[model samples]
Target: AENNRRKKLLRSAQKSIMLWDPDGPARKPPRESAELLVSADAMFGLSDSFQRCTSPDFLLHTIGGTTRGAIERAYDWLIPIISRLPDTISRLPPSTSCFLLLRAYGADGERRAQLKELSTPLLHHVQDSLRGTLGEAES
Candidate 1:
């Protein structure tokens, strides 16, 4: 009975919270598209997982020598400046969004090459880890 009442209150609270927002209903992510993940509440936009390489170690190492140089230039030039503004603040502000967009336009060339290099190593480790985990889970 106590748990039931608490659950009811939680549900009501959630409903009330949702009502305060003007953006109709919240939509889920497409999960595979390259859309900007902006939110009025977000301090920073969400990140993307390139080629399913979401792991930090994988990203840090994968993001490359010459490509890293390019990205470093872009990162310095872009990424952080625009990632912070709330979508509704309104106006052309100096944000990393444009830099990132510009970088993204070129990101494919270097990123693809970097990804190609990282892919084999990443797949090998993922396959190995999944095998062990799946085996353990099955047991």
Candidate 2:
């Protein structure tokens, strides 16, 4: 049941990502795409869903060659939610966190500073967690 639910969420996220294209001829307008991306149902468990559904190497892969406008629009909608993630949720792998920060900060300079400030404690927590895990392994 849990696996089925996760698969459903993955499919839904993929559909949402496809529909979010801002430049495709049949795509909705940028504003609408942004709105859809931020909708609660659309965004539920977004980070975990994405991480489970796609390998990290391919996460955000589509945005790489896309126009900055499309990437920026997505970031605009995503940043607020990303900022509010609890420490438990925000405890993403280092690479994932870096990718998120790069996109979030690239979209809004002001947020870069705020996110940096907020991440300090989260980073320390993650480091401590890693240390504990390593210590247990060693013991």
After superposition, the stretches of candidate 1 with alpha carbons farther than 4 Å from their true spots are: 1-107, 134-139
Task: Give residue 127's error in model 1 in angstroms.
Answer: 0.4
Q: What residue pairs clash in candidate 1, if any at all?
A: 81-95, 81-96, 82-95, 82-96
- Judged by lDDT, which candidate is best? 2
- True lDDT of residue 5, candidate 2: 75
lDDT tens readout by residue for model 2, 5-107: 7566555555555444466554433544544554654559565565334455233453343354544554543445445544432334433444454544454
Clashes counted in candidate 2 amount to 0
Residue 8 CA displacement from its true place in model 2, Å: 28
lDDT of all predictions: 0.36, 0.49
If candidate 1 were superposed on the true structure by all CA atoms, what would the RMSD be? 19.6
In model 1, the Cα lDDT at residue 118 comes to 38
